[model samples]
Target: IRYSVVAGGFHEGEISCMDICIQRPIIATLSKEDSSIRVWNYDSGECELVKSYHSLQKEFQNTNQTYLQSVALHPSGFYMAVSFIDRVKVYHLMQNEIREYRSLDIKNCHSLKFSTGGQYLACID
Candidate 1:
């Protein structure tokens, strides 16, 4: 079987990384070139949310040194963590919206993953 997602005009830059939620039919993609994250409902091939790092945090703007590295969706499908050059930001998913929940000051974080039980998040610097 093949799953085709209509993400033609959504991500302007090449997608750097992506992750699927274990508890939901959802997918999250990251575009390092544009510092953006897009959440999608894979079951219906719909784009649920599109948010740029620069828009969520001011420090991300006007700085070419910072770029998105990776993204991880929680097992419960209620949270997401995005890694950047200097830090990792966690967001809460609710009502088709994403809100910043917390952040970690980990430099050169290239990967992120949530535990199978959703009890912890691991970052590889």
Candidate 2:
């Protein structure tokens, strides 16, 4: 019932493509104008930007008009998940880098959710 929301810069004329971790303190998103995914820090009102959500894109998925379709957080909060048009990627919060441990390709992954227990990830392709 209590929270702090911080706003960040975005791609020109680009809408926010993201999903919230309900009841959690993190958010994930992408912007075509910026060509990146941004993971926001939402605790203690630190007002910090954990940029480098996703820095690289494959040739076919790279475009100036990309939009993140979905996002989720591992139950443990040690990791975060982001979904794109052609892939799904996870990140390690502490390392501030991609996990490089897993990725899913099914195209147009519009939504994703992590089981409360963190047992499995449900991604809608």
Which candidate number has the best TM-score?
1
What digit string (tens of lDDT, one per residue) describes model 2 on residues 85-122?
76887767664454555777767877788887878888
Clashing residue pairs in all predictions, respectively, total 0, 1
lDDT, candidate 2, equals 0.62
Q: Write the per-residue lDDT of candidate 1 for residues 8-98, one digit (tens) a residue.
A: 4488779889999988999999987777889988887788888786654456567655567899999988899988777889999886689
Please report the TM-score between candidate 2 and the true structure: 0.61
- Give the clash total for candidate 2: 1
Top candidate (lDDT)? 1
The 0-to-1 C-alpha lDDT of every candidate, in the order given, reads: 0.84, 0.62
Clashes in model 1: which pairs? none
